[model samples]
Structure formats: C-alpha cells, structure tokens
Target: MVWIPGGTFEMGSDEFEDSKPVHSVTVNGFWMDEHEVTNAQFAEFVKATGYITDAEKPLKPEDYPDVDPEKLKPGSAVFTPPTHPVSLDNPMLWWEYAYGANWKHPLGATSTIEGKDNEPVVQVSYNDAQAYASWAGKRLPTEAEWEIAARQGKPATIYYWGDSLKPKGQWPANIFQGDFPWQNTAEDGFTGVAPVKSFPPNAYGLYDMEGNVWEWCADFYRPDSYTKNAEINPKGPSSSFDPEEPGAVKRVQRGGSFLCSDQYCIRYKAGSRGKGEVSSGGNNLGFRCVKDK
Candidate 1:
C-alpha cells in the first residue's frame, strides 16, 4: 500500500457530460493499494474464506424474473471483439454474456488464471469487490479519494502522466491502440489487460491508475453528481441514477480499462468517470482497495 497524501485537487473534467462542472475536492490521507488486486491476491481471499463471487453464484430466479430461465445462469459480460469493424453505437456487438465466466475463468469457463496470477482479476461485481475489501480489512476508496490519488499531486492534465497521449513516444498506460471493437494493433504492448505495474507508475508510485481495468469505487453513481456541491470528501450521491438506465443501480467506477481507445471510449483520460450496475461484472472491470489513515 502507498500513502496518498491527499489535498485539494480538481476532481472533474469539462470534456465529459457527467464529469462536467469541473470542481475542487478535498480529501484526507489514506493508504491505497499500489496496484489493482491481482489473481493471486483474490485467490488467497477465496481460498481462505471459501467465498463465492457474484459471477460464480447462481442467479436467483426471483431477481431476474423477466429473463428466460436458461439465460439466468451464472456468467458475466466478456469483451468479445468482432473480426471486422462494427458500429460502436451498440456495445452488444463486442460484449457478450458468457456463461460460466467468473474471476477464476476471466474469458470463460475454459480460460484459466494459471499463468496470469499477476494480472488484475476481472469479472468481479461491486458486491464481490466489497467482499474482498472487507476480508482484507480495507475498504474501497470513495470517488473523491480515487480521483485525487490518480492526480498524484500534479495539475489536471489530459493524461495522468502529462498532456500528451503517449509521452516521449512510449505508451505510459495500457489502452487500446487500434480500431475500436475490432482490430487492436497492440501498440501499447498489450492487447488486453496488462499485468499490474506493467507500465510506469504515476508520480505517487501508483500503477495502472489510468487503465488496465476499470476499478470499482465506493459510491453510488449519478450522472449529475458533479452538479451537487461536495467540496470535501464527497461520498457521491445518496442514490444511483443514470438517465439512460434509470432502473439499473450503478456504482462509480474509475481508471478505465484496456479496451479504452481514442477512436472510441476515451474515459481513461484523467478526471473522467465510468459506472456499472452493482450486480454486473465484466472482463474489463476490477478494483483496488484503500485503508483509512
């Protein structure tokens, strides 16, 4: 864990609608994981507690009453890129609900984490992340804490490293470097989620703060969250609200993921925000932990 000496910093960006009204936020010092939780770490938690992640649990028929009985099986959203270019309008083109896809089998039931213990564990829901944090005696960082830590005492810039997308002609973070939802040139030395600390750490010595995998945060997501006044240690809105999906409850997710690309999703940029339904998990999403100081 790294000690994040928190202070006031600009917490939002005007570039994105949800992150509009760039605001100042203050936070206290806290100990944050230097990298996202890895397969090894999560494996230990599961072995010790015999914990069953959300992706591995059977779906309650009552919870998904409207869905087909067969479709309610245990699984998660996996990023299955198309062989050819496809319209980015609908994410369904590249995302599929793979049955038996869980943290243990990141890609699907046949995939294994045997040689990828150091990689960040994906396919974990908000509830699963919370469970791991609790077992580790830590908690997920609040959205304010997460943004401030990612800033790393530096002034707001397009990227965490600097204003340039690729500083000094080198990939500073793991992000898509080719066409969206199709071909990935892997110009960043990674076609998917890179192992933790594979890229240069931020000024605060934190790894994968901008990409690698979208990280779960401890806050209910609201599209208009920035419009509300929360100058100090803001814990986000009291409830989740996304105008696009009003019925779905979502939590704030930060750091973006390897799938992010300039041609499509650019949420990896500093101060940008991401959100996912609390019950949903995906191959490109994971989380880190923070301890109160």
Candidate 2:
C-alpha cells in the first residue's frame, strides 16, 4: 500500500448527462498498490491461502446451459489480433473464445505464464480479487478514491491528463494507439497487456489508473445513479440488474482494460467503468488492493 496525499477533486462529467454536475469531493489519506496486482502477487496470495480462482474451477453443465461438458473446461479471454480489418460494430473482432485460457495461459491452450512474471494477472473475478485483498489485509477502493487518484486533469478536465487526449505529443498511458483492437501500432511499446508499471504514474502516483486493465472497485454499479444524485463521493448505485448473472450484483470495475478503445468501449479514462458478477472472471479484468488510513 502506497500512501496517497488526497485532496478535493471535481468528480463526474458534464459532457454526458450521467456524469453531469461535476462536483467536488475530498478524500483522506490512504494506501494503494503501485500497479494492478501482478501474476506474481496473485501467486503469492494463492500460495499463502491455497486459493483457487473461479476460472480454474470447472463449470457445471447446468451453470452454462447448453454448454458442452468438455467445452466447459477452464478458459479465459484471449485477444487474437487480426491480420486484416474486421467489422467495427462487433467487439468480438479481436477478442477470441480461447478454450483453455486463464491467468496462467492468457492465449488459451497454446499459451503459458512461462515469462509473464510482472504483467497484471487477468482472468480474475471480483470475488477472486476480494479474497486476495482480504488475505493481503486490504480492500478495494471506492469509486471516489479510485477517481481521486486518477487525477489526470485539475479535477474538472474530462481526461486525467488534460483536455487533449494526446498531450504535447506524448502518450499519457498504455492504451491501444493504432486501429482499436486489431491494428495496434505498438506506439506505446506493447501490443497486448504490458508489464504492471509499464507506463508513467498518474498525478497521485497511481500507475495504470487509466489503462492496462480495469481495476475492480468495491461499489455497486449505477449507470444512472450520478444523474439522479449529488456527485460528491458517490458510491455508485445501491444495486442494478446484472445481465451476466441471475440477480443484482454489487461490484464496480474502473480504469478500463487493454481491450478498451475509442473504436469500441472508450472507457480507458478515469471516468470509464464496467462491472460483472462477483464470481465471474475474464481475461482482461484484474484488480489492485487499497487500504484506508
């Protein structure tokens, strides 16, 4: 946990009605990881707690109705860059359904974690990150805390760095710089997920707060909550419909993932967000732990 000297930050965005009434909020001092927890860190947690991630557990046939028992084998999300252009309307243009992908094997059956010692561990669910955080004696940060640390601008700017996406001809963070998903120019020195601290830290010294992988937040997601309430220290919605599950879920994911792009989900900014069932895991989602002071 790294100490963050927090202060008042203007929250939300007026450009979008949901992020309107950009209000100011203050946060006390707290601790946050320098980067998203890496595979090595997750491995340490597993070693200390004998924890098994949900992706490693087999999926029962009933759980995925109509799924082949063999097809239910452990897997994770894998991004297979296309050799040519694909439909812009479809996100699946780059993300493939690998049969045996996981944190250890991000590229499905053919891949292994043989060399990725510092990359942020992907394929982790909200519950998976929570368990690890609990073991580490920390908790996920609230959305307010996350955004405060992701101070790209002087609080009110739409982006963390400034009003300009590419400030002074410099790439602010590690995001896809070429054609989204497919034709990555690797202008950011990476084609897929890069090392944990591959990019420079934010104003608050938080690494990868804008891109890399979406960090799971401890709040429930409420896409419309900001529009309906005060923007000060908003904790997301109390609850919401989770199409990924059978009932309401209570988790918020921020910071955006490598899969995020202007061509697809332009959620790599400080204000971007997404969530999932607590028990579900994907190849692009991971988290970092935070502790209150």
Per-model TM-score, in order, reads 0.98, 0.89
Per-residue lDDT for 40-126 in model 1, tens only?
999999999999989998888898889988888889899999999999999999999899999999889999889999999999999
Clashing pairs for predicted structure model 2, backbone only: 13-19, 76-101, 152-160, 152-161, 153-160
Q: Whole-model lDDT for model 1 versus the true structure?
A: 0.92
* CA-only RMSD, every prediction: 1.0, 2.5
Model 1 Cα displacement at 213 (Å)?
0.2
**Per-residue C-alpha lDDT of model 2 across residues 1-293, encoded as one tens digit per residue:** 57877777776666554445666777776899989999898888888888888777777887679877877877666777788878877767777667677777777767777778899998888888889999999988887888777773364565676677778888777777777656888777776788877877776677888778878988876556555543445556667655545365757788777766666767765565676677666767889888877
Please name the candidate that would achieve the greatest lDDT relative to the true structure: 1
lDDT of 1 at 48: 99
